[model samples]
Target chain A: MKVLVADDEPQIRRALKVGLERHGYKVVEAADGEEALDVFAEQSPNVVILDLAMPRLDGLGVCRELRGWSQVPIIILSVRGRDDDKIGALDLGADDYLTKPFSIEELLARMRAVLRRVEAGQASEPTAVTVGELTIDFARRTVTRGGTELHLTPLEFDILRYLALNPDRVLTHRQLLTRVWGDEYAEDSHTLRVHISNLRAKIEPDPMRPRYLRTEPRVGYRFLSGRS
Target chain B: MPTTRCVYSYAVALAGVAAMTAALAALESVRHIANDSMLYLLVVIGVAVRYGSGPSVAASIASFLAFDWFFVQPHHGFTVSDPAEWLALVLFLCTAITVGQLTAMLRSRAEEAGQREMEAAALAEASWSVASQLDLDHALRVVLDRVVQISGAGDATLLGEKAGAHQVLAQVGDALDPAEHGLLVLPLGAGERIGYLVLRLPPGRELSMAERRAVNSLALHAGVVLERDRLMRVEAQTQALHEADRLKTALLSMVSHDFRSPLAAIKASAGSLMAPGEPLDEDTQSELLSGIITAVDRLNRMVENVLALSRLEAGAWRPMVEPTPVEEVVASALEPLSAESSARVEVSLEPGLGEVPVDPVQMAQVLYNLVENALRYSPPRAPVEVRAWRGYGSFVFEVADRGPGLPLGSETHLFEPFWRGPGLGESARAGVGLGLALCRGLVEAHGGEITALRRQGGGTVFRVELRREVGR
Candidate 1:
């Protein structure tokens, strides 16, 4: 994946460039706002990492300017470490954020997840797909297991729709809560786990050995189609 | 026709002349009664015209006798020839003078009383309408107007100084046109020309000394009003400054409180990572672990400084003074220092160190700052010492180290915020110099003094002195 990284400090810029390149990304670097904009225009990077504070122009200013012309996925990296800065960058149309002194493992995982979502958004032409004895139709709001019709609540249908879109991947408890109940429910892991268990009972033939719903131990829950 | 004094004097002069003329006439015109009465009537008529008739009756009776003696038809005789003439002359002369005297006296008294009433009403109207305003500027304006109305001086002002400039606060009677006329200002402040008191000329009149005195009092009263208003303005300005200071303190406290959450999270995570177990890679592992511990300590110190600064700015700090043992302060300082101090910090107490009256928390803060400062300047693995000694009736606590001492002639700038060391170009540990400032503030608040000293042996020493407890 081609990625663009922007930061003012030389040390931070070097560390991020080395780490991202090791993770198999074609890394491009910019020292400030003018350079970042110039590199983005020339290279058309798949993902962009922006530092919130820079010498010539700030991250929010760049985010706003870039959003005016492009829909590329952007992640803001910052030392400000404040929720207001995070929310400001996100509201300016950037997709995600990571605070400073962060480890490489977390950065790689977040980068892949955002890239996968962006790829899927472009690949889709139509909504419904049927697999095995189970039939799913997003337009008609219907689901079947072993050719038997399964009743699902309105909230359960939304959860199933998000999982079916991802197909097979791990989703942290925080992400699942935010995707389902909302950002305020990000801390309520008990509520998310209970709902996930109830969903498995309805869809899986044997709920004990989940076919579609999978748990990544303490991390979170995942909807597994077993295709990937 | 005449004033009361002039008319009274005229009456007396004419009466004396008439009395002489009457006695001479009584003697000489005893036989000329009819002629005398006619002459008396003529004199009284003249008196009535000149003296408003009150003195006319007496003059007329006296002059009539002279007329009888000098020009009566029967000469040098006591009896009248005709009884009819005798009765007519006496009744006509007496009755005419009495009527003239009575009418003139009533007119004179009534006019004097009416003039007194008009003066009273004019004074009342000026006092009520002009003295009604209590506002300093408005009152001064009205005071000038009232002075002019009461004392009849034209164009007045109440003058004073403000911000090193002369100001005429209240000048409403007449615009005085000070630029046109070279009107001089009077300061009223210790007899120097602080400001002006202006007045213009009134047409066709000169001010009496009494009237001038009354005008001076009006200016004096204006001065009193101006002084009161200046005090009020000063009070309002002070209140606004206080409110601004209070708002700054409140904002600081709110921001500091919000920052603690993140610091708590970082500290907890770092501490857990340093726990002793389930780890490999022993090459310089101790140093990496030390890095985590140092980060936690720095975070903790930052949090503490923020909280203390917020409290200090908010005016929430109240010094609670008590007789505190010097040992307790040393123990408290050592407890925190030992946790992070790489070298063993040894504490020494001189014998007979007495209890010092001070706020315990603030005293501990002073000791803590001193200990930290000593540790920063000292070499790695060098021993640092805390000593408490009583000298000259005051308790002195000091921290001394064994390393390269402070730069010579650098005392003045060392305590400033964000200063760096000259010797060390770069180091893992760095500071913004908030510690010594806090130390100074805490020590001074408890009526104590603290200073840094260049140790003769080596390194630096920070000494703090608290007032010795008296009367148990």
Candidate 2:
């Protein structure tokens, strides 16, 4: 994998380049946001990690311009670590965000996750997600519990599919809202909650004490498989 | 000059007697002379009320002479032929002079009362108008308006001293040159003159006693208002200084306590790594290297926290909102954790969990801080569970660690900056206690809230709630 690390800090750029290269990835470096765009066009790196603050054409601008044409996974690195900076990059279609003083391992993992999601989008392959007695067939857009067909609204089915795909992992309300209802509806956690309860009523043995679709108080919900 | 003024008074007195005698002569042709003396007394009283005691006394004496000359049988100069006529003239003279004196005294007293009432009304009205205005300039203007009205002056100007020179704050009527002479300038305020109230009267006109009194009262009212406004401004400035002082104290404490430890650690570790001679073993060197990195990281974190706190207090941090997936934020936050720490964190993300409109970077920082705090407080193998879900119209994130729960009564101050729990072990007191405070600041910046609770299974659970946007 070829990864481009664009940062104004020499230490960070050098460290990331050395560290990522050691992990069997070709590393490209840019001193600023403008240079990052130039290097990105010329080298056509597989992934790009951008720094928010740059001398000219900051990270948000670059992210916006890149997202216009290529759906390349873009990760932002911000020293300020303010919400606005992160949200600006994300809203402009950057794939992920990381604050400064971040570990190289975390940056690589985010890059991988973004790239994998892109690959998954391109493959267009359907898969079956089975958790406990509930099974979701992505290809057929069907869900069954214990070999019996369970009727579900399309919204409920989508919520379940997303939860089942990432079993045992906690998803935030915002994540669910954006994925299911698009980015514009990302803040509508109430709608997500209602749908989640409805999904639980259908799949969970007891809606009050959900087994498959479990509520993680103050967070979101987690789909815990029977095995872990 | 004195005799001439007396002659004018006697002339007025003679005119009153002559008019009265002519009228009595016409009445004598038909009516009896019983009330003739009483008619002369009426003329005496009228002269006393209109003019003063000098003219009235002269008129009373003149009427007696006219009565003796025209009506008494001996119609000559001032001689009385009968003794009865002499007695009647004496009684008439005594009664007329006494009535004239009494009438004059009552007239002066009534005029004094009228003047006092007018002054009191003007003072009351001026105070009401000035008190209604909260702004100093506006109050001065109202006072100037009152000044012109009450003084009957052609114009009025209020001058405030600035840099040793008077500047006009408010003016009414014709524009008067600032250099114009003969202005009725009264100094306003109690001690040092805050301003001057200048009134220009009409040409050759003088203010009455009541008008002069009204002007003085209005000036006093204006001074009181101006003084109050100055005090309020000084009070606001003092309040701002106090707030700045408080921030400085907080910063000093933070620097003294939080900033020093990491610097000391980094210095010691770097010194060992760069030491001369046989060079340490590979294991020892790597350990020292990691130590150096950890120390630097801690220092960086402290700087970021301090900056964040200042930014929050300054109200400079504005959240850039976007649709952020909670799981993505949690995952990103966990990315920096060591392998052992990562293993200890048990993340249970609700599937199909949608996005929330928030500043994801701030939210991620909140998650990172909570998780990091949990790691520090708990044993290496003890599990820390991070969970997220939707509740009502909000998204919730909770970081629960199986560590010693917060000390009793410490939960309330958990999110306060630099607040450390008492009776903590040395290892538990490893951080500067800014993590939770920064998390609170970041979360609140997005219109969210953060709180802490004791877990039922003996741990501390920090919960964050971000309100969901309704109807997009």
Candidate 3:
């Protein structure tokens, strides 16, 4: 796999290049957003790791330009306390985000997750999906946990089905609401919270420390497929 | 000078003399009354009290001629027959003139006193408005209203001049065109004109001499008010700049001491590994690497704390409140700690303590900073306790540590930024002393309270109480 790293900081780019190269992945580099686009078109990398702040054009601008014609997975790198910028990048069709000061291992996990999501989108939907001990049978519209059938309301079942299908990708409140409850209910996050809380109670062994459905706080929710 | 008023007063005096003469003639024909001419004094006194000295002098001379012509021995003429009668007539004329002049003098003095009283009342109202109202435009509007009432102007405006441009500060009634001719413009201030009080009066009307004096004094009062407002603003700006300077000095000293130590440690560790001496053993090499990592972590934490403090002080961050489970808040707080440090913490929570309306991100940050502080100060092998419960319609939590207790009388100072406890040795873990201050700012922003108290059996407990329902 080839990864394109774009950042204004020379030290960060050098560190990431050295780290990702040791993992046996081909790495391409760009010092700013405008160059990142040129390099991306030339190299056609499989994954792009973009920083939010850069010279000439920002990561959001690059994300918007790339999304206009391509579906290549893009992960955003942002500093902490910049939640609005992160959400804006996500809304503009970026795949995922990682706050800065993250470990190399954390960045690798996010990269793997976004790559898996892109691969899954190209393939046909699976009838049955299993993560940990929980099994979701899309064909039969049934969910079973630890070999015992768990009863779920139809609305709850639809919410779980939508999240389970998108496995490791983060689904914002607008995305989930429009898909499960229709576009008219896209802004009603409070209702989504109530149902998700109820669903977590029935699915997870420990609702306090969720293993599958995780909150992104002020952003949205993500379904961890117990992969990374 | 209004000639119409002077003419009207003389006409009234003429009418009074005619009426009195007719009355005296009728009385003389009915019965020969002694000293009938003395009755003409009534008309003189009436005119004097009503019309002042101008018309009363005319009435006194007119009354003397009428009495001689109609009631004296020489009828219809100013001639007297007997010498004694002539002396009596002369005495009567002298008495009428003296009484008329005295009554007119008293009346004029009374009118002057009333005019002064009215001017004083208006001035007192203007001064009160200027002193009480802090809003310059509003106060000036009140002053302009009084100017209109006293000067009888159709409209009034207070105009401030700056760099040869006139700007209307306050206006009462219709807006005035500054370019209009014949406006009663009064320059304000004692020596140099700072502004102009422009009054537009009704066509063909002008202010009385007394009204003009009152208006000028009012304009001066407005000038003084404008000067006072400018001085107050300058004083406030100076105070703000002084406070900012003090904070900057504190931050500089803190950065020099706290930031240097971690940088020095990192440099030493990295330098030793890079030295071209004998190759170090594996254990020593790993130790140096770990040392570098530890120093980097310390520097990162310090940077985060400083950034958070500045953001809080600048009011750039506000809690994005939502309904969140307390359990989720606790989990996120513990997620950042190392496994070994996490093992040292013992958690206890009230059963079924459900969700709360709060900014989960900020609340988690508050708890994390408190726990980290507790873990750092705790003695080796001593368990730090984290407890949460709902009480008194509020959600309360505390982090307790079996470490050195707080110094006496330093409870309040503990939460102030850059305040470090005394007697901490070099071996003790050092922090930039911003964690607790950031916690206080976040908690208070949530409409909550945070406090630190000495725990029993030699430790300190930091407690946070948050409102269960935050207002949107």
Superposed model 3: Cα runs more than 4 Å off: A133-163, A173-208, B1-134, B152-168, B171-228, B278-291, B318-332, B338-358, B380-383, B389-395, B425-428, B466-472
Local accuracy of candidate 2 as per-residue lDDT tens digits, B1-472: 2567668776877798899999998989888678587798888888888776888888889888889998887777678889998999989999999999999888867866887777787677767766676767776777787788777788888777766887777888766655678888887866888887888887766777767777887887777777787788899889878866876776677677767777777788889888888879999988887887787787787787888777776777767676655554665577557766777888887877867777655677788889889988887689999999888999989999989887889786888777766754334254446778788888887878899999998999999998898232
Off by over 4 Å in 1: A79-86, A123-228, B1-472
Query: Which candidate leads in lDDT?
Result: 3
- What lDDT tens digits, residue by residue, belong to model 2 across residues A1-228? 898888888998899988898889999999887898899999999989898888898888889889988888888887654556666676577766666678877677676666766776686554887777888899899989899999999999889888776565456667788899999998776677667756766887644235677554334666766542
Native-to-model Cα distance after best TM-score fit, residue B374 in candidate 3, in Å: 1.5
Error of 3 at B421 (Å): 1.5
Off by over 4 Å in 2: A1-4, A24-28, A33-46, A64-71, A125-228, B1-243, B246-250, B270-301, B311-472
Which lDDT value does model 1 have at B310?
A: 48
Interface RMSD of each: 24.4, 11.0, 2.6
Q: By DockQ thresholds, what CAPRI class is model 1?
A: incorrect
Q: Second chain only: TM-score per model?
A: 0.44, 0.58, 0.74
Q: Name the top TM-score candidate.
A: 3
Candidate 3 reaches a DockQ of 0.36
Question: What tens digits encode model 3's per-residue C-alpha lDDT throughout A1-228?
Answer: 999999999999999999999988799999999999999999999999999999999999999999999889898999877888888898888988888777788888888888787888889999999998999999999999999999999999998998888777788888889889999998888788778878887998866457788888767888889897
Candidates by DockQ, descending order = 3, 2, 1
* Poorest lDDT segment (10 consecutive residues) of candidate 2 chain B: B423-432
Residues B371-440 of candidate 3 have per-residue lDDT tens digits of 8999888887789888999988899989999988799987888898777667653322544268888999
